[model samples]
Target chain A: MRKEDMVKLISAEGFEFVIDKDAAMVSQTINNMLTSPGSFAETQHGEVTFPEISTTILEKICKYFYWHLQFASGKETEFPIEPELTLELMMAANYLHT
Target chain B: MMGGICSRKREQLVIENGGCRGVSERFCKIASSKWLGNSFSRPIVDCQPGRGKCPSLMDLCIYKIREDIDKYSSFSILPRDISQQIFNELIHSRCLTDVSLKAFRDCALQDVFLGEYPGVKDSWMDFISSQGSSLLSVDISSSDVTDSGLALLKDCPNLQTFAFNYTDQLSEHGLKHISGLSNLTSLSFKKCDAITAEGMRAFSNLINLEKLDLERCSGIHGGFFHLKGLLKLKSLNIRCCKCVTDLDLKAISGITSLKELQAFSSNITDVGVSYLKGLHNLTMLNLEGCNITNACLESISALVALAVLNLNRCRLNDDGWEKFSGNKNLKVLSLGFSDITDACLVHLKDLTNLESLNLDSCGIGDEGLANLTGLTLLKTLELSDTEVASNGLRHLSGLTNLENLNLSFTLVNDSSLKKLSGLTSLKSLNLDARQITDAGLAALTSLTGLTHLDLFGARISDSGTKCLQYFKNLQSLEICGGGLTDAGVKNIKDLASLTLLNLSQNCNLTDKTLELASGLTALVSLNVSNSCITREGLQYLKPLKNLRSLSLESCKVTASDIKNLQSDALPNLISFRPE
Candidate 1:
């Protein structure tokens, strides 16, 4: 992907996951952070730091973003979620408004 | 300089005080430090002491507000835009209940589109109305707001638009409350039955009202009399209002500024249409299914600005078609199911600006199509159920801009397919005729841009499937001709772009067809009804996660089997046959 089309997401543990802007936009909150008229620091730097979200959950969210894009284009498949991570994932999903 | 030094000391104190509390507290300390710095100088807000950089203070406040929304009672302290964003976020997440709604009471939200939101009732209007003059548009469609609840909006003086569609509880009395809102420009009460002719008296005061949609308002018969004073009213839709008659049209004719009138299926006739001759500015007139005959065309031709005219299913004949010769601006004309024959098409020959013409179910044939050759700008031509045969297809070959051609139920066959091969811009082609055989499908392989191809009634056997390879962009393919077999489906299995695949009535398609089609992962709607596929074929559909509507009617699969698959494999399936 082109550098202009990518975004860096830093988890609470400072683990960085560079992903496509289109995939990261699967989360409505991230889309707002990047495109909202306010021009927040995340939009300026092309990076967002989620201090409350852990590295594992952030990585899973990035995977889900890509899976969501694939599923939208008709490559329908199951998005597996382990039972132990369901609660945290649900909270993150709620925050992201995905 | 002294002020900046004091603020820096204060920020240091705040950071020390907030160091042990974690992220949210640290953000609060930073926000407070920024506020203190704002009093001293603007530069201090942009550059923090220790932190490399901080997010916009507005973003931080919005984040903080979202994290602890219930802790505060009112967002009145924040800027209007910040409060509005918070309100939108709360509403988007569906977390804004009656209790949480109190925080945005006076937040000055400009637009509130809570259409079809559950739990919305009369009580919520108080909080919505609290925005007062700041509220410009509100759509409470499908809500339970009665006249008493609507009365609360009387105080919002600057409110310009309101949509209360399907809010059946609103009666004539409720309209009286909004009569004072002269600034209101657009209002929609679609499918509202309680607003009768008497209730429309309230609209006389709305001088700036430009658009009014009272579609399906069965009670409003003589309502146009009250709308006479709405000088700025440009578009009015009273479609399906069975009670509106010739007298209503007469009352409406006085509004010469009217640009569009949709009175389809109304109780208006030719006499009613004659009353609209004064509306010279009218650009769109839809009298479809109205009792208007050919005599109405004489009056309609006066509408020099008419770009779209729908007279489908009207009492029109060929006698008055010459009246359409003056409508040079006509871009879209729908005369489907009319009594006009090939002779009437001669009048339409001069309408070179016509882009979309619907002659479906008309008596026009080959001679009629010859008159359309000069219409080079024509993009969509519908001749379904007409008498146009293969000979007429030659006339349409010149229409290079034609993107959609529906020749279904016509006499066109294999020989006619070659005429369409040159129309390379065709994206949607419907050949739902029994005469369309494999030879016909093979003749048009040059039209590679085809995205939607319907061969619903065409006879295409296994050998015919070879033509399908050229249509790599086919997103929706229907081959329910009953001639397709497992071998025929094998040719279509690789069409990765296919989202809707219907192979119903093909008795030769057994479980092998499903196995062959398993690779079409993008199939969202698959209909193999009346096929020989058994219950075992359901397993092959597990990979089609986007499959929502699976029709296996007249097959061995039972409703319980579909339910079992829905619970596990096909979790996104919404509609399944035998259920």
Candidate 2:
């Protein structure tokens, strides 16, 4: 729909990854921040700032979110990760709970 | 114009009533309209309807908002926060299955009850391990969960209640997995036959265990000795464990915190039951089929808090029956198949709070029923196979709430049916009387709410069977005898809700009975054994494909006839007995 309906996720290097609210909600942490019980800063502004997450790891997290959404809908495909990005990707996966 | 007028009056009511009920309907109208326009930040205000005198407009707005919210929640792609709320609703509605559990896979679930769910054993532990300490209570009773699956729950230190009844592969060793959960309070191993007395060593660390059920566990004989240190144990059930004797009760008799004990069909006798001498807090005790006699009742009567006492199949004669009259708190007393008689009825007159009394097959007769007249609160009186005829039923007229009365195998006939006409709330009547004829069945048409009617040996002619069609609520009809003919079954096939129909031993019934029974699409159980129907009659039952159990025993139908029948005929049949 509209760009305002989407949520903006800002990484450590000020790299903003804006996506549809439905796709971004595949990450449970982002979904909780945007739909917490009361009006917290992220829920009010529709934007979350992850200072600990780097630009590369946050971009991978956003891609993994879309992949999870497709996987949940019965789509079976390889979600390939490079050997060098494996350990860091796993760390970010634990943080985002993708 | 109506919307404007409704909004204007709603604004006035909102300003008057303020916070609780009338919390501004204008906000809901704006929020609902925006929710329809792709905005998901709709304020969800939870409210209990009919709590206050809110105006109809506000209630209507809440109803419409809830309807829209329900539509939004049913979608598969809901946000995590909103899905958790919807998950709570699904749990309350008892709709959580393996398929639905995937929707909230990321959220930490509080209670998971996968009892008897297929293929839930292997991956269930893997899923709970992901929960990471939010799991509190789980009941995987009668499922495929084994000891290894239960061992995975060791990480859940806060887990309180775990029930693994009928988990076939789980042994006493599997119980060792749950030893370290210090918060574990209740454990049920009902018919989980792998648990022995040695397996109980796993539960020695559970200091908070309050209730333990070991019904039908054959391996548990001297397990009571292992539970001596559990001071908080209040309820224990070891029903149908034949080896448990009075000596086992003597080992745990010092645990005065015991409130409920069920050892039905165990080898415990008067000496075993006497060990429960001064357990004042004991509320429910079931010693049905135990060898306890007259002397055991002397000590049992002292437990004043005893509310439910089931001595079914026990030898509770007249001498032991005298000790029960003083225990006024008894609400349910089952002395079924015991040697109690009319002399025993005089002692039960003072039991004013008795709600359910089962004296099935004690030969209470008319005189015994007279003594039970003062129990006005009696709701269920089961006197099946007793000598209490029509004359005794007049004493039951005062029990207005009497709902279930089983008078099977008595002198009840046409006159006896007239006696039951006053008890309007009777829902189930099992009159397996040989003397009841077509004339007596006419009196039964007045009991319109009857759901179960069993006349096992009664002779009801085809015309008399026509009178049964008036009971449209009848779900089960059993008239297994030699009297019912093809025409009698044909007249009663119009009962669209009939699920179970038994016409066994009706020798005069022919292939015409099959033709009429085929139209009964709702019939699940159909028994036409000992009839004159041959292989030709098997073709007529093609329409009864929904039958679950079909018995053609002693009929003229051959094994070759069953082989030749169409493959799709009676496809849902699970039980088939043919001759």
Candidate 3:
């Protein structure tokens, strides 16, 4: 993919995950950050940092974004999650409005 | 490394507090300071206060509260905007149960739209009423909230808009609770049977009320007397309230501020319409299905501002057609199903501003259409079930702005369709007549902008399907005649925008038709009821993920075959036949 079509997401532990801008936009919060007319640091740099979300959870959210896109395009599949990660994942989902 | 460790420890402490108010406030300060440090170092990006570039403190608090909602007693400690967003999110995600709704008590939400939400009973009223004087608008339509539940809204004195449409549990006693809401500007109680003339006395105090819709309130006969004090009232809709007679019109005649009056299908006569002559500001008057005669038109002729008039099914004839010549501002006129014939249409020749004219089920023929040739601004013309034939269509060829034309059950045949070929703006054309053959369908190939084409009774054979290739924008196509075969289905399979396709009663269609149509993924409603398709063709519909309604009646496929498909591949299918 072209460099402008991708975005970088930094977790609480300073680990970075570079993903497609379209896939990362599955989160309404991130979509607003990138596209809102009032240009923010994230929109200018094409990178967003979450001080609350951990690295493991951020990676899982990236996977869910791609899975959501595939599912919406008529590909049916189940998204797996560990039982221990359920509460944190749901809290992050609520914050991101996924 | 030290700062990172400190931040993690603080985060753990915030989570351990179970989202208590004091700890969450400290967490917001720490998060904001960290972002401030980052912005100073970057220097190019200014994270200004109140810009909302970064997530606000309230967003984090709400996120924490949503994580464990059962731990908190109420969201009253948070700011009104935060609590309101949380309340709206809970309702939007369908996660707001009666137990979860308690957190929003006294949160001061300005609006609550819980229309048609299931399980909304009287017990939820306490949480809603706790918003108190801050509430502005509420729509609890179709809810089970009773008189006691409505009584709770009396505490919300600042309400400006209230709608309780189809709330059968509300009676005359329930309306008294909201009588003190003088700030109310718009109120609707549509289809509420309990609103009698006695209950409408509560409206006397709503001095600021501007729009009131009491449509289908069966017992509201003498209610207009109570609304005399409402000087700000602008629009009143009492359609289908059979008890409304000439006396109600006499009572409403004093309300000169009325601009729109919709009293269709009421017991009002010509004498009742005579009471409306003083209301010169009236812009829209719908007297459809009333007991009014030609004399009513004489009374309303002074209403020069009357832009829309519906006289369908009234006692109007060829006489007094001269009264309509004065209303030059009339843009929409519905005279369908009336006794007015070709002689009456000559008066409508001067209505050059008319954009939509409904002459359905009238006695208008070729001679009547000749008088309408000057109406070049006409966009929608309904000639369905009339005496209009091929020769009359020549007069309508100049109406290039016509987007909708209905010729269903008329004398329009193949020779008449060539006259419509120049109407390139036609977006919807209905030719549900037995006389329209394949030749007629071929003449309409130039109307490529057509999104809806209904030929339910036309004799469109397999050869006529070739003409449909030009209409790639067709979202709804109905050809219910028995002449369509599997070869015709191939021509329609590439119309990717088709959401509704009905090939029912065509017995020649088989499994090949279903196989060809499997590529139409946008189709939501598909009907092949009387076709020759069998159970083997049901597998071809698996790719249509958006298909919601599927009908396969009188075919070889059984109900079990459709049920299995619905359960496995087509989970979005809601309505299916053979059940």
Candidate 4:
């Protein structure tokens, strides 16, 4: 949720943007819970780690989320900004839902 | 003029917290002593700047009034931000019609959107320029816009949806500008006559475009650019693109992504259609007016995914229908105006999934109804203007899901009513212009969920009114014959939800019929045409505020009666014709 460090992944299709998250904690997949233990919760089980998600896709997804968050928050103001940024942000939102 | 400016600013003032301080200050500046002395109207505020002079008598007269703006400052009115927020919400959510858009554009630059957002003239240029880069959808259909002015959209790299209706106004240049929008996924350029094969080549650049509609753009020629490059394109409509030949269909073999293709009126023949065998994903194909021969069915049969096929007026015969029998996925088959015979229904026996079938004016007879029994999932069946009779309808009762049954013509008698009673799901039953009597309507009591029942041109008299009470969900009842009397119209008051009551050609109806019908507050469409409705009947309709389309045609009313109907707040009146 911190605004500065986050980034977003813009998909090939202009409609969707994705976010990188701790799949074990965010997703209910049991395989993710076992391999990515620390990513799921703050526990003593250090052997298990996050599974299924690769580092490259996660980085792209995280960057996409950050870009969209900035655009959504900046929508209201005295200055009317370009909507092209919003379209990408909207696409990113749709990707995250998937 | 000087004082008018201050009032304009005050009216434009935003409510901050509860005080109207901003408006008051602006008003006071224009109400200075020098200007206040020349004022024709009295001023109420006594406050004066700089001098030690006592408040003037003129100022006391203006501020003394209780209706002054100062009195409204005490209430917790809407905040300036919240009010602007509401205005923004309304602007975006409201459907701006063509007339409203014209009015908005024609307004003085300062007045346009200024009444809501003051001093917006400086930011207006930036607003339009930014729209090009950020906007996702642009609909400039039927406007006085040209291709040269489309540079406004060049910066919009993220544009995905664009709908243009040039009709006869578009030229090749306009299409070239559209081709530059490479990122578009959905594009509709319906009826743009200026578009041709060259304009189509422009679309070759839109590799990512998914849906394209060039419906009725007859000038477009050649199939130089296929959608094979557009790996994601799903729907393509070139309906009535006359110049496009059979060779153009060859390009479709490359587009594996095509799911729905509508080339209804194109010159596609059997040779050209064979190329569609590769389009295994095609679910819906409309070939309504194509000069297709019996040989075209051989190629069309290859599309296993074909579900809905519209071949109206395609000169298809029984042989063509035999080929389609194997298409189990065929659900909606429309063969309207085709020269198909009853023998063709033999081929339809294999299509068990078929639900909605239209054989209107296809010369089908009693033999066709027997083959239709195979379609167990059939819900809506249109047998209008066929050679079948009421006895044949008995076989259709087996269809449990049958909801809408249109037996508009072709010898439907009172006996057919017995067949429909078994159809529990039957809601909309059209027995229009059929030979059904009051006895047939009495059998309709079994259909409790009947909402829209059309017995137009049937032999049902005022006696049939008693049977209608059984239909709990009946909202619209049509009796287009000289049958219903004033008492029959009065009996309709029991049906509380009756919104549309059509008693056209019911010669007995007079001013009393209008009085009886007006009791139904939800009367949306009242058709008293070819009746004896006088000016008094028109006067009675004034209370039915919800009357939208009122047809008093062929009546003895004068032009003065029409003027009265026009004066009423007939908000939904789109068509009004007095007979």
Candidate 5:
């Protein structure tokens, strides 16, 4: 998937994914949610919107989710951020229940 | 020749498009080379014989751009520096096999294989060899590489961590080879039967060696006698080394920094442990299967900071453990397979910070377990294989923060579990191999955060499934050896977080039960083995993306079901067992 297209799609979900895809995919729950269309339905119609998720948090979560998916799929990417940054992402994941 | 190079270059340009282009370009380049001058004027088939109509320019451009941005920038095709960095990253990952391992080994062993490839550029070899000095750890476990491989590694001066499994392959000569790498701080040699006292002494040259293991080295007679050179040694494991006696332990007592020690199945007696009185920094000690008496624990009492101590299968009766209670800082104590009785409970009251206490098969009754309530910080308490009754569980109500409580093979029943409503933090409660009915399981609704609740070998029927629907956080539900059938199994689909659900030994369950669980995509560990599940049931798990560990032990699964699992099919699967 193209990076800009992914950013635009996930921006509608309300998370900011800053880091590369490696760190984001550690939570298997988020990866599966990203792949399937109905996994993250915002409303009753299942239009796939992250209305509850803020854009900043959506961007970070999307970037982290992509990094993790890339890392888990065995595609080459940058190393994970420091352990402290990982804890921050974990907190974000915990807040979103992802 | 010049005309052939340009066409080959154009073919190379196309070859870089994708895997398909590479094969065609190689064939076309070979065909154009042999038919030198006649190819330019010949039919289009001469230049591109098997080529389908050339793809449109736009399609070629799309493929080229996709290849350049995604496939082209792959580490294997990138510049030497970035590819070398990727190679370093692969090695740093600590575990690899097959193709990834071959790539890493090829990149690092460039210097070793350079003699065969004389025409290879010097810059690539230099870039690879420069990393030789930066490696800090080496694992030569279970490999056929011998002393020659060790000799090649003598240049790694900064190497600090090393592990070797099946070290019987190394002789005294091979052990001496590592003495040159003086920066070694940790080393392990598993199954190294050929090592002698002289071989161990050669490692004394490593002044920086702080941790060492010589497990299963039967020939280590008087191997640990020389300890003056090992003044910095802190952690040691000499399990299964029978030759070690009081003399070796006395020598180790002088190393003040030694904190963690394992002497399982050794000849060390009370006299040997008496030397440990001077080592005050000791925090963890395991003396399982040792020939020690009550006097041995007097030395262990001096280790005030001791947090974990294991004395399983030791000669410790009530008296020996009484002397051990003098150590106030103990938090985790294991006395499995010991002669502990009611009298042992009196000494356990002082351990206030105790988090985990294992007294499995200790012949303790209700009165003995009642003394354990004084330990308020306890989280995990194992009383399996004991003769305790329902009254024993009543005393456990005081441990409100307890998360894991195992009561397998006890006399507890439906009335006894009512006492457990107080343990609101309980996440895992095991009642396996008990006579408890659904009435007892119904009492567990208070534990709302339960993730793993095992009721295998119980009398839970379909009605028990109704109470279980409330546990949304349940990840592993083991109802094996129960009366659950296809109808009972359908209730589990509501558990959205279910990763591991074991319904083995349910003879009544059929293919439909497995089909219901197949929709649970979050499942990673599933065991429906030994049931009436046939090939049709096995098909349900084939598309499960996250299924990692699957156990089909004693089931009717066939080899064809195994063939369906592709090598890299379920990318996340770590273990798959089918029978």
Candidate 6:
């Protein structure tokens, strides 16, 4: 993928994940940060760091992003999630505005 | 200063169009140039919504450039809803130019009501065409929209209601394109004089058309023949179509589902009403000034489902209204300015379900109203310009449900008001009695629920208005031709809910009254005609933000005072009558 079409997300354990910018921007908080009039430090380097989110949670979030893309396109299916991660995922969703 | 004026004008436009709903909430978002108090950089960057928090450097540079260019238009940084509100205000104010409209390109608008705008033309439609399938309602009334402009709307599929009233440039060819919009429910072509019988043929394609108003489209004679297939049409108005006789009514009589048909000022007579008996679903029928008589009333009596009927200014007498007794389901009966008398009311008294009975300017006196006393469900009783008096009010005392009562230009004196004072549920009372003075005004103090009280042409003085001060819920108070002065208005000043105050012909009113009137922030229409108010008195009325119509006619106001005052004093003023 072109450099402009992808973004790098760093989790708390320093695990880096490169995802399509379109999927990453699906999160309203990320969309606001990426498209806001004033440029922030994250926009300058095309990378975002989440200190509070762990590597496992971040991986689940990335998977959920792809799932959202499929669901928005009228693909109906269950988005399976581990019962233990449900509370953390919901908290992340609240912060991100989904 | 221009920003201030434009911002206030925008606010006024929104308030005018939205009527105190979303207008004020939307206006609160816009910060004008004066709000900065000398404009130190203007906070244009900070004014940006939260979504504008972290754009790339390239995007930031472009946004900065655009903000600098949009220096005068203070709503540059608002969100889509606020921008849409400003766009609405801009269209109504006739200030929406092509350049300014570019700002709201991303606005997701559902309804675009650009009615009677002088600046709008094909470009506005071109802008609307870009709104895609989301546009649900569009009113381009009295604009320069021609056939070409309407052709642009061919791409707008979801447009359910389209009104082009007085946009007479549109013809049969223009209407043919949109006729295929099966989802369209209402199509108003009122005063589009260019439309002929050929244009009406397009309506057959509008399968879902529920309401169609062709009022004053006199270009066609027998147009109902084309609308015969529009079986879904529930309401149709052909008012002022003189060519529409009983023959046209016979053509549209096939529309059995029609619930309301307003053919006011048409050529349809008694013969035409006879054709409507087959339309069993018709609930409301207005045939005012149609030259119908007792024969028509007899024919209309067969429509048992009719809940409302207006026969105002018809060639009717006592015998005509007698026929109405058969259609016992009538909830509203308007017989204003008719030649009917007490004998008609005797027959009408059987219509116990009647909720509204207007006998204004009818020859119904005390004896006639006695028959109406049995209609205990009667909420509105209009006896203006009749021979009713204090004696007649005794008959109405039993009608506890009476909410609106008009005894204007009647022989009702001080004693009459005493009988009416018992009606605690009376919301609106018009006692334009010539003999009414301060003596009977004390009795009205008990009516705390009164919203509208018209004591016009009465002899009530300052003391009488003092008694009226207790009616805190009064939204409208008309006290013309009285001894009401500044002290009287001081009592009037506390009624904050007052929207319409007609202190006309009260020659004793002066500056003190206007000073007290400044506190009426909710006032919309104020008429101080033929008063003693001087030009200097206007300074006291500067705080009336919602005041739209102010009539100072025959007052002592000078041309200089009016000229000296800025439009900001009464920014929403549309009608200003000064001598």
Which candidate leads in TM-score? 3
lDDT of 6 by residue, B366-417 (tens): 8888898789898888777777766888999888898888776789888667
**Residue runs of model 3 more than 4 Å from their true location after superposition:** A1-98, B1-95
Model 2 per-residue lDDT tens digits across residues B80-167:
3334444555544445556555545545666666655556675667666555477777787877877788888877888888888886
Q: Which interface RMSD does candidate 6 score? A: 16.9
lDDT by residue (B1-579, candidate 1, tens digit) is 101111122343334222322112211111122232233221312221123332222333344455566776876765566577777766665667888888888888898878777788999999889999999999888999888888999879898998888877888988898899899999999888777899999899999999999988888997779999999999999888889999998998889889999987889999999999999899999988899888888899999999999887797779978877999999999888788899999999999999989887799899889999999999888888889998999999999999888887899989878999999998888887898999999999999998878887799999999999999998778887889989898889888898778788888899999998899988777878888989998899889887766788889999999999899898667667767
Q: What is the lDDT of residue B436 in candidate 6?
A: 81
Runs of candidate 4 with Cα error greater than 4 angstroms are A1-98, B1-129, B223-228
Local lDDT at B294 for model 2: 79
In model 2, where do residues sit more than 4 Å from their true spots? A1-98, B1-128, B137-151, B165-174, B191-198, B225-234, B254-257, B534-546, B556-571
lDDT of 6: 0.73
Chain A only: TM-score per candidate: 0.96, 0.90, 0.97, 0.31, 0.38, 0.93
For B1-579, candidate 3 gives per-residue lDDT tens digits of 111111223443333222322213211112212222332222322322223233332343344455566665676865566577777656654567888898788999998978777789899889889999999989888999999999998899999999998888988978898899999999999889778888999999999999999988898998889999998999999988899999998988888889999987889999999999988889899988899889888888888898889887798889988877998999889887788889989999999999889887789999999999999999889887789998999999999999888887899889879999999999878887898999998988899999878887789999899999999999778887789999999899999998878788888999999999999998777878888999999999999887766788889999899999989898777667766
Best-fitting candidate, scored by DockQ:
3
How many steric clashes between backbone atoms does each model show? 0, 0, 0, 26, 22, 5
- What does candidate 6's lDDT look like per residue over A6-53, in tens digits? 888899889999999988987888777777776787776678888878
Relative to the unseen true structure, what is the C-alpha lDDT of residue B212 in candidate 1, on a scale of 0 to 100? 94
Q: Write the per-residue lDDT of candidate 4 for residues B119-221, one digit (tens) a residue.
A: 2222232332344454566655554456555555575677888776544556776667666788899988777876677767668788889998888777776
TM per model? 0.77, 0.66, 0.80, 0.68, 0.69, 0.73
lDDT of 5 by residue, B271-314 (tens): 98898888888888877778986678778888887888877667
Ranking by lDDT: 3, 1, 6, 2, 5, 4
Q: Model 4 Cα displacement at B172 (Å)?
A: 1.4
Is model 3 an incorrect, acceptable, medium or high docking prediction?
incorrect
Per candidate, native contacts kept equal: 0.00, 0.00, 0.00, 0.00, 0.00, 0.00
Error of 5 at B417 (Å): 0.6
- Model 4 DockQ vs. reference: 0.02
DockQ (0 to 1) for model 2:
0.02
Task: Please state the Cα-based DockQ of model 1 relative to the true two-chain complex.
Answer: 0.04
What's the iRMSD of model 1?
Answer: 15.7
